[model samples]
Target: MSDSTVEDFLKSYNPEVRQLVLKTRAVVLAVIPDAIEQVDSPSKIIAYGFGLKYADLICAIAPYKSYVNLIFSQAAQLPDPRGLLTGTGKRARHVKIKTATDIESPGVRSLLEAAVASMTH
Candidate 1:
């Protein structure tokens, strides 16, 4: 069996959704410069973490047919005064990205930063 890569994973998404995912990925990488990114082809997710463990996971760029979601593992714990997160999950929440502008939304960077700090600190 061949190992799936981020490129291979993203290739399945549509062009517009691919751009949004790439933009979201750039923001995540910019916020967490040293983060290690892992790809899950089956889940259609590109996860970023400080280390190779479930607990170390900070966020994931999950792509769908029409949009992408920036999934945060610590969303419930993060102080999101801007209310950018949306999810009913007890431990995780996600911000939907329908456009590149959504990825650059005011609260997105802050949330990403907090997610990184939550695990590193």
Candidate 2:
């Protein structure tokens, strides 16, 4: 789906989640200006594309009551040289953040960059 589609989906989500989704989108935009947002997924996930070549290597964000979830579609493929992320679920992996403060960590920035690299050219 296109960015507008993604925004619409988020708009329909629970208010708490919707707010976090907006914040997450802002975070992604700050880092990757050219990234595209798409909500046209049957899986209920939002994707941020780094470029056409790396479109699938996404920064996926979802929300919960207590905290927001930021997922790296290619987390399994990232170097993880610093072991900053932790998740063992099938299909995808993620780094959970209890507060927006967590997003400011240097490690998170590196992870974001690596996530983008893992997907596209």
Candidate 3:
């Protein structure tokens, strides 16, 4: 999707939810500067990947009514010693970010680092 599409998606949410989504996007991009952004309106999420295909997807930012989710695509393979990621999916897991501070927390940063590192191996 286009950049404008993503911008519109972010704007579609309520002010509070919109702010959370913007913060989540900032955190993800800050952690993985080279990650390619994929805006999927059908799924209502913005995904970041190392390559053009789904297999290269590293994570995603999904906005809900109450919070935004930082979704790790290969969460099953990442190191999560803190047990912060929550999910029952075969390969994906998510960390809910309710506020801006959650994005800067050490636990969240570590997870983002691990997810990006996984792209090389």
Residue-level lDDT of model 1, residues 1-85, one tens digit each, is 1224666777777889888888998899889888888887777788899888889999998999999999999799999998989
**Candidate 3, residues 13-67: lDDT per residue as tens digits?**
8888888887888788888888889888789989999887889999999998888
For model 2 the local lDDT of residue 83 reads: 74
Identify the leading candidate in terms of TM-score. 1
lDDT of 1: 0.87
* lDDT score of residue 42 within candidate 1: 74
In order of appearance, the predictions have TM-scores of 0.93, 0.71, 0.92
**lDDT (C-alpha) at residue 9 in model 1:** 76
Best to worst by lDDT, what's the order? 1, 3, 2
Q: Distance from true position, residue 94, model 1, in Å? A: 0.2
Q: Tens digits of per-residue lDDT for model 2 on 9-115?
A: 76656676666667766777777777776664566666677543443547777666666678886677777666767788654677776766777677777888777
lDDT of 3 at 70: 90
